[model samples]
Target: MTNAHHLQNNKPQDIAINDDWFDVLKISDYLFAISEPRHYEHTVVYLLLGSDRAILIDTGCGIGNLRRVVEQLTSFPITVVNTHTHLDHLGSNHQFSEIMMFDHPRSRDLSSNGASRDLLHWELHREELVIPPWPRDFHIAESALPPFKVSRWLKHDDVLEIADIRFRVLHTPGEAPDHMCLLDQTHRILFSGDILLNGPVWSHLDGGDVGELRDSYERLMRRVNEFDVVMPSHNTPCQNKDLLPLELAASNDVLSGKAQPQVGTDLWGRRYNKYDFGRISILSKYPQ
Candidate 1:
C-alpha cells in the first residue's frame, strides 16, 4: 500500500493538476482525503477503497475538477455519499453517476438547484492563502452547485460493506437534519461528517438545532468507546477521540449558559451567539 502522503507527493498528469484547487492526502493505502486547503472552508472529501468497491464521502466545493482527481486515485467502482445537503459538501455531486444520501427534503432541494452563487459568495470572502491561492481565472460568481439526483436513499443503521470493511450508518443530526456519520467496525474509526470538527460547528444555519445537536453529542459520547479516531469533513483530516468530549462540553455549556457567548453574525446577516472552547467552538442561535 502506497502511503497517501507519499502518493500525494507525486502528482501525476492524469489528475487535475490545479496546484491550488485540491490537496490529496493519503490516510492509509486505501483511504485518502481530497482537501481544498486554499479555500476558506478547507473542505475535505474522503475516498475509501475496498477490495470490491470504493466510496467517496462529500464531493467538496465545486471550484475545481474533483472527478478527475478521484479518477487518478483508483479505478474501482465508486459510490458517492453526502454527509448532508450543504452546498460546500455536495458541490461536486453532478460529477458522479451514483449518489446515496438520507431521505431528506432539504437534500432534495439542494441537489436540485445546485447551491446558489449568492450563498457561495459568503465562503469565498473568507478565503485565506494556505499553500496555494485560488485557481487562476477563478471567480466566485462562476461557481454554482451542480444539480444531481440521489441514486439511493440510505436509512439509519444501514450497513455498507465494501470488501472486508463494514461501515454502519449513524444518523447524527444537528448541523443538518439529514446529517450522518459512518462507523467502520473493521477499523473502529468514525467518519463524523460535519457533526463534529475542530472549527466552529454551525448550528445557526437553517434546519440546524442547538438542542438537538446537544442530544446528538450526548449520544455520540455514549458510543465514544466504540471508535478510536474521528474524521471530520473540514479543516483537519483526523482528530483524537478526546476531541468529542470537548465538543460535547462546549455544546453543554451553550445549552446551560455556563460559558459566556460573544455576539456574532453569520453569512446571512443573522445574529447568533458564538461560544469558543479551546479545541472547538459552537455557533448557535439562542433557543426560541
Candidate 2:
C-alpha cells in the first residue's frame, strides 16, 4: 500500500497528456485511463480493449469529443457503459449509440435530462482554478449534456466477456443509486466508478445513502482479496487494493459515529458533513 501507484488529488504531473484536452494514461495494453484534469471534477474514464470488442467504463465530461479520441485508439465495436449517470460521468453519452446502464429510475431520468448549468457553475466560473483552460470553442453556459438512449440494462452479477477479459458486475449503490463496480476477474482489477476514489467520496446527493454505502463496502471487503488494483472515476487512475479496507472502515465510522465529521457545503451548495479518513474522505448529508 505505497503511494507510488496512485495519483493523489488529481495531480498527475508525471503522466504527459500530449497537449490534448484529456490526459491519457496507458495502464496496460488492453486498458487506458482517460482523464479530464482541467475541470474541477477531475473525471477519469477507463477504455478497455478486449479481443472481440471494447468497453468504455465511463465517458468523461463532454467538454471535448471523447468518441473521436477513443476511435483513434481502437477500432473494436465499442459499448459505452456508465458507472452512474452523473453529469461528469455520462456527459458524452450521446456521442455513442450503444450504451449499457442499470435499469433504475434515476438512470432513466438522467438519460433524457441534460446537463444543468446550475450544478456546473463551479467549473463554469473558471476563477482561481487549478487546472488549465477549457477548449477554445467550449462554452459552459451554452453547453448541455445531450440526452441519449441506453442500449442494454446491466444487472448485478451479469458476466460481460469482452475479447479476453471477463467482467462481473457488482451492484454498488452509495455514491449513486445505480452505481456499479465492474470486477475484471481475469485481470483482477476493479472498475469502481464513483463508488471509490482517492479524493472526497460524495454521498450527499439526493439519493446518496451512507447506510447503503456502508453495506456495499462491507460486501466489497469480502472480495477485497480478489482484486489487485482499483480504478476509480475521479482524481486517481490506479489505487492499491489495500485501500479497500480503509474505505470499508471509513463507511463504518460514518455509520457508528466513530469519525466526527465537520459541517461543510459542497460546490453545488449542498450541506453535508465532511468525514476525513486517513487516505480518503467522505462527504455525506446529515440525516434529516
Candidate 3:
C-alpha cells in the first residue's frame, strides 16, 4: 500500500535511450522497468541484469523500438522471457533472437501466427486510447505484430539462472493459460504478469478463468513472505507484497457472490461484470 510513484519519480541518470514511446525507470542498480505510457494498457516490461547475461521480461505493445531501447540498457546478450503470449506483451518478441515461452497451446498458436493488423485495428485507430506525441516512425494503418520463434518452451517450477541471478518460473495461469510469473527469490521480487496489475484484472477474456485467478492469488498468498515487491506488467511497476491479500479477498468475494458488480463493456463490445476493489478490480464474464 506504499506509494508506488517513487519508482517512476526517481529517474536514473544512465539511461541512453531518449525516446518518447518508452519510459525507463531504474528500480535498482541491477533491475529496470521499461514501460509504454502512451498506450492505454500502460504495459511495462522488466530488465534484470546479472554478471554475464540479462533477462528482459514481457515486451510492450511493439509501438516503438523496444530492442533498441533494451540494447542501450545492457550489453549482455538479452534473452526475452514472455510471461504470456498476449499481443501487448509479445509484440516485440520478434525483435529478440532468443525467446522463452510457456509450454501451452495458446502460447504456440499466438507466437506462430502473430497479431495481424485486423486484430489490432481497433486499438491502433483509437486516438483517445493513445496519449499524444506518438512515435514518429509508427503508422497505425500499417502496423502488425510479427511472429517470433520460441527458442525454448518452459514449464512450472523451472529455474532459470543468468550468472549470479536466478528466477523460478511459477506457472500462475489466469490472465492467460500460458501466463507465468518470474520469481527472483534471492532479490525478493516477483515479476507478476497480467495476473496482478494496478488496474482491472480481465478474467472475462478468452481463455481467462476467474476460478483459476482466485487459485493463483491464493497460491501466491501462501508464499507472500517470499517476495518483497511485485513488478506488475500494467499501470504501476513496483507494488508491495501486501497487494496479494487484497486481490485474493476481492476474488473470494466475487466467487462467493458476496460482492455486487457493475456491468462493463470492453473496446470489442464484449460485456463483463466488473467488481471494483479500489486500486485493483476484476472483470468477469456475466452470469458467472
Whole-model lDDT values for every prediction: 0.78, 0.79, 0.83
Residue 59 displacement (Å), model 2: 0.5
For this target, which candidate reaches the highest lDDT against the unseen true structure? 3
- What are the root-mean-square deviations of the candidates from the true structure over C-alphas? 4.6, 4.3, 3.5
Query: Could you tell me which 10 consecutive residues in candidate 1 have the lowest summed lDDT?
Result: 6-15
Compared with the true structure, what per-residue lDDT tens digits does model 3 show for residues 116-161? 7787666543577788866898887777877789888998988887
Per-structure clash totals for the candidates: 2, 2, 0
Instruction: Give the winner by lDDT: 2 or 3.
Output: 3
List candidate 1 stretches off by more than 4 Å. Answer: 1-19, 120-133, 136-142, 286-288
Candidate 3 stretches with Cα past 4 Å from truth are: 1-16, 123-126
Residues 171-219, model 1: lDDT tens digits:
8888889998888777777888987888899898788887889888887
> Order of candidates by lDDT, top first?
3, 2, 1
| Deviation from native of the Cα of residue 53 in model 2, angstroms | 1.8
Q: Which pairs of residues collide in model 2?
A: 51-163, 52-163
Inter-residue clash pairs, candidate 1:
4-26, 114-145
